[model samples]
Target: MPAIEVTSLSKTFRTKRKAAGLGASLRSLVRPEFRTIEAVRGLSFEMEPGELLGFIGPNGAGKSTTIKILTGILFPSGGEAKVLGYVPWKQRRQLAYHIGTVFGQRPQLWYHLPAIDTLTLFGKIYELDDRQTKRRIAELAEAFEIEDLLETPVRKLSLGQRMRCEVAASLLHKPKLLLLDEPSIGLDVVAKQHIRDAIRTMAAQENVGVLLTSHDAGDLEALCKRVIIINHGQIVYQDKVSALKRSFLTSKLVEVRYAQQVGADFRIAGTETLKVAKERYGVKLRFDARITPVGKVMAALSAAGTLVDITISDPPLEEVIAAIYQKAENRE
Candidate 1:
């Protein structure tokens, strides 16, 4: 069976409307105004065992709501859902043993206590025996490279170190499904890579399915093979990461630093000079990867001046997501 299955799942929230004026407020006291907001609309998807799926969307696009419903934190308004063969909302307690969750903004570790203490507490909560708990902790500490940070107080650890410990704690029970929301948020590049490597290793060895929600494109690119992107509470795109790039990634940005000064009039065919710092021997250029080969651009740059340093990168993921959203909006 698939690790997760959902058919037309939806959620609606009832909220009180604000009163505008004093008279309106007084009248509202007698009878309050209300509004119904649809947070998730007819969402359906499936994840297989050991699959790394990227569940992504813009702010308030129902990403968190969908995760909450799947994890049984909130009940859905409509539709059928099953995770690991259990209805999350109906069998939450039973399902808890098979799944793990980590919300980057919310720390599950006790602030004043060492992370090792929290891990022990979690082991007890999960009903692991004493020997089993110690063995699991040692394995996780090694996997996450947090062996040195285990005894450090949660408050004293750096954001990256704490995050590593948090992830390790979640895995102590050897859950079959892991839900990670912004796991790499507020982490440096090196720290992000560490989390990614650990997650990759765990998923491979444990055969644990992962549903990762992150705004960092690097995380998605490095970890997820398939992605489901939602906007306006509906899926706008779902496909392989490579396919998404091929369809939406049309341009490349190149930055170069020359060893010597270059003229302001420096130009290359099929490329646009975005910025030119003549005195500093720095230039930023952009070209359509679909039209002009990156090899040609590199050759042009090399011929222009003695190259000191060069970097090439795709456009930010936000830009790609915006383009997809705009297209979806236009179609509407």
Candidate 2:
């Protein structure tokens, strides 16, 4: 059976309309206008065990709503879903034992308590034995490099230090499924690498299925093989990361810095000048898949002038996503 399966799952939230003034706000207490907002509309997908999938979308795209349904924090209004052979909404109590969740915006640790105290609390809540809890704590602390932070109070630790403890706290139950929402948010380069490495190691050793949501494409590039892109509460694209890039992007961006001033004709054939500076210029050029490869980027710029330096950049994931949204808007 698939580790996670959803068929036309949907969620609609009823929002109350409140007026601006205090009189109107007080009046709302007597009677309120209700608006039904569909957060997730007819979404469906399946994932196998031990798979690492990236779920990404713009704000108001219903990414969080869908995750809430899959993790059993909220009920779907239509269709159905099965995660690990159990209906998530109906079997949340049972599912909690095997699924772990980490929310980047919220710390699971208690502020005044030491990091180890939070782990102990989680151990009791999950009903783990003393021996199992100790072993899991040791393993995760070592892997996450939070051994020093264990004795420090949660509120006193640095953001990166606290994040490490948070992740370690969530995994103390030995969950089979891990749900991470923006786990790398606000992390610096070195801290981001450490978190990504820890995630990769856990997924490999524990054989857990991970569903990660992040605004950072670098996180997806480092941890996930497959990605599901959502827009306006529906799936826009679902495919391998490599295939998504290859199929959606038709052009590459090249930035060049010249030794001296160059004429307008110095531009590449069939390329557009995105921007030009005193001694530097950026060009957008189409690549015919087989004709112009990455290796030829510097050489092509050399033909234009005495090239000082040249760099090739892939189209940003945001650009590809915007293109998809524009296509949908046009069709609509």
Candidate 3:
């Protein structure tokens, strides 16, 4: 069975609108105007057990709202949803036992207290016994490389250190599912890689299904097998990461080296020459595989000279996401 099933989920928020003038504000207090914002709209999707799913979107795209709804933090206006065979809104407490969550902007740890203290508190909340909690903390400390930081006050720890603690705390009970919303938001490249590696290791060890939402495309590429892209509170694209790349990540960067020096002008038909080596034996270029097939490009390159070395790589995922959003906007 799917670990998560969300069908026709929707959330609407109402905010009181105020006018410019003081008199208008006073009058609005008596008869206030309200603006209805559709944060999520008829969203439908499923996640299999032990799958890493990426839920991504621009700011205000309802990614957070959908995650909150799934985790039972915010009740949706209309929808039927089941997470781990339990309806999240109707069975929040029961579902909490089987799921973990991390929200980037919110700190779950005590500010002045050590991270270990917060972990202890969570252990109690999850009903873990003292020995079990200690063992789990030790294991997580090793996995996340936070054994030395656990006793340090959360406020004293750096962003990366604290984030590692936050994730470790969420896994204290070994939940079957984890929902991470921008857990690596403020982390540096090295720190981000550290957290990603730990998460990958733990997910593989425990078979935990992860539903991650992040602005960082690198996170999606590194952690998720499938991706769901949403914009303006609705899904625009949902597919396997490789399929998304093949479909929209059309552009490719090619670096080629010939056995000997070729002419100064190193160019190829249907491909844009980005740069040529000063000695003129190597060239770098780009092309859309959709327009000029890989086979054709390779054949053309071989025809130019004896191939010594060649590397072909796709454009960055950020570009693919941007292109998808722009295409959606153009359609609108």
Candidate 4:
């Protein structure tokens, strides 16, 4: 059976609407206006054992709501779903033993206590045997490379260190599935790599199925084999990560510093000049790699002026996602 399964699952929230004036706010205190918002609209997907799937969407696009529903934090408004063979909202206590969750913005570790303390506390909450908890803690500390920081106070640990511990704490009970929300947000490159490596190791060694929600494309590219993108509470694209990149990631950005001044009319075919600092002899250009070969663009720029420095890079992941969203919107 799939680790997670959903069939036309949906959620709607009732929210109070307040008008924008002091008088309106005061009047609303007596009787509040209400609105119904559909946070998730008939979404359906499944995750197999040991699968690393990327669940992504723009802000307010229902990613969090879907995760919350699956994790049993909230009940869905309609349809059916199953996680680890249990209805999350109906059997939340039973399901809790089989799943792990890590929210980047929310720290589960006690702020003033050492991570070890929290780990022990979670062990007792999960009813893990004392001996088993100690062994699991040691194993996780090694896997996450947090053995040295285990005794350090949560408040004193660096963000990266604390995040590593947070993930470790979540896995003390050896969950079969993991729900990760922006696990790499606000992390530096090195720190992000550490967390990614640990997650990869856990999935490989424990065969843990991961449903990951992250804005960082690197995380998806590095860890996920499949990706599902949603917009306006509906899926816009779902495919292998490789296929998504091949279909949409076609543009490259190039920056060049010329040794000699460039003329006002400097131009090249299949490339658009994004910026030019005439005084400093610098120019920025963008082109579709699929339409215009990088070599040809470089050759044209090189011939135009003596080059002091040049750098070429792929377009940011945000732009690629935006283009996908635009394509989806246009199709609708």
Candidate 5:
């Protein structure tokens, strides 16, 4: 059986309308207007044991709602979900024993308490024996490089330090599955790198199945092998990371620099000419997929002027995701 399986899962939330004026409020006490919003609509997917998948979407895209259902924090209005051979909502207590969750915005540690204390507290909550709990805590502290900061109060630690502790607290139970919701939020370059490295190591060494949700493309690129993209409460795409990139990619941008800014009107033979914009430093060319070998484009540009620097890149993922949304909107 798959480690995670969600079939036709759906969740709906109801919002009540409050009257603005006193008289209207009094009237609303007798009868109120309520609207039901389908936050998650018939979403389905399955993950094998030890698979690492990136779950991504824009705000209000049902990513959080799905995660909530999978973790047994919220009951789904429709469909079925099973994690580790147990129905998540029906077997909440049993499922809790096999999963670890980390949400970036919330810290699981007490403000004035040292991280070690928090881990110790969680060990008791998990009903872990002293020896087993101590061994796991020691190993995690060393692996995450938090040995020096374990004694410091959470409120006094830096963002990176606190994050490492949060991750450690979740893993004290040695859960088979890890659910990360924006684990890299508000982290600087160096701190993000540290967290990403730790997550990768955790997965590789422990064989933990991970379901990660992050807006940071860098995080997805670094850790996830497969990506599942959601939009408008639906699963629009799900596949290997490379396959998604190739299927949705529209154009490639190349920036080339010459020793001197070429003033002559120049064009590459095989590529769709997107018109060159020349600045004092270099020329930027936007090309289409019809462009033959990138090597040919490079050679043609080199012939025009001494090539100083060259970089070829894809369009940003945000843009690709937006395009997908627009297409869906047009169809509707």
Candidate 6:
């Protein structure tokens, strides 16, 4: 059976509308208008056991709403979902033992207490034996590099440190499935890598399925095998991460540094020069690999001057996702 089975899953929220100005507000209070927001609509998907799935979108794209519904934290307006073979909203209490979650914007750690205190409390809440709980804590501390931070007060820890602790807390139960919403938010480059690596290791070791949502493209590239892109409360694209890259990650960003100064108007054929260093020794460029082979660009740069450094990368994940949204909107 699939780790997560969501069929026609949907959630709609009704918000009371208030007009501007005191008079209008007063009248609205007497007869309030409500706006119906379709946070999730007709969503259908399934995640296999031990699968790493990326569910990503822009702000207000219903990523968080879908996660919450699957976790049984909110009632969906319509449709249904089963998490680990249990109906989410109907069997939430029973299903709680099998899943872990981390919401980036919400704090699960105690503000005034050290993170260890919260972790220990979770051990009890999850019914973990004291001996096993200690062992798990030790393992997670090493994996997350939080042995030192665990003792510091959560309020005293930096956002990155606290986030490491928060994710560790979620894994205290050694859940079979993880639902992470923006797990890498507020994390720096190195910190983000640490979290991704740790999560990947833990998932592999335990055969845990992961459903992750993040704005950072690096997270998806690093952690997920498959990705589902959502927009306006619906799925716009779903495919293997490699396939998504092959289709939309066509352009490459190349930055190169030379050992000596070059002409200010330096340009390459079939490539766009995004920037040239003020020192005249370095240049930033972009090109479609399909048009100008990567080997050609490298050869041209090599022949120009003694190479000092070079960097090549794909366009941002946001750019690729935006293209998807545009294509979907045009079709609609």
On TM-score, the candidate that comes out on top is 5
lDDT of 5 by residue, 103-206 (tens): 89878899899999989999999999999889999999988999999999889999988998898888889899999998998999999999899989988899
Cα-based lDDT at residue 205, candidate 1: 94
Task: Please give the CA lDDT of all the candidate structures.
Answer: 0.91, 0.84, 0.94, 0.91, 0.86, 0.92
**lDDT tens digits, residues 139-194, model 3?**
99999999999898999999989999999999999999999999889899999999
Please give, for residues 1-332, the per-residue lDDT of candidate 1 as tens digits: 99999999999999988768899888878999999999999999999878999988777889888988999999999998999999999999999999999999898999999999999999899999999999999999999999999998999999999999999999999999999988998999999999999999998899889999876778888889999998777999999999999888889999999988888877889999999984859998999988999998899889988999999998987789788889988998
Alpha-carbon RMSD, candidate 3: 2.7
Model 1's C-alpha root-mean-square deviation from the true structure amounts to 2.3
The order of the candidates by lDDT, greatest first, is 3, 6, 1, 4, 5, 2
Where is the poorest 10-residue window by lDDT in model 5? 272-281
Write candidate 6's Cα lDDT for 22-114 as tens digits.
998899879999999999999999999999999988889899999999999999999979999999899998899999999999989999999
Which residue pairs of candidate 1 clash?
none
**Model 5 quality (TM-score):** 0.92
Error of 4 at 1 (Å): 2.3
- The positional error of residue 30 in candidate 5, measured at the CA in angstroms, is 3.7
Model 1 residue 237 lDDT?
Answer: 94
Clash pairs of candidate 3? Answer: none
Error of 2 at 116 (Å): 0.6
Q: What RMSD, rounded to one decimal, does every model reach?
A: 2.3, 2.5, 2.7, 2.4, 2.1, 2.3
Error of 3 at 315 (Å): 0.5
TM-scores of the candidates are 0.90, 0.91, 0.90, 0.89, 0.92, 0.90
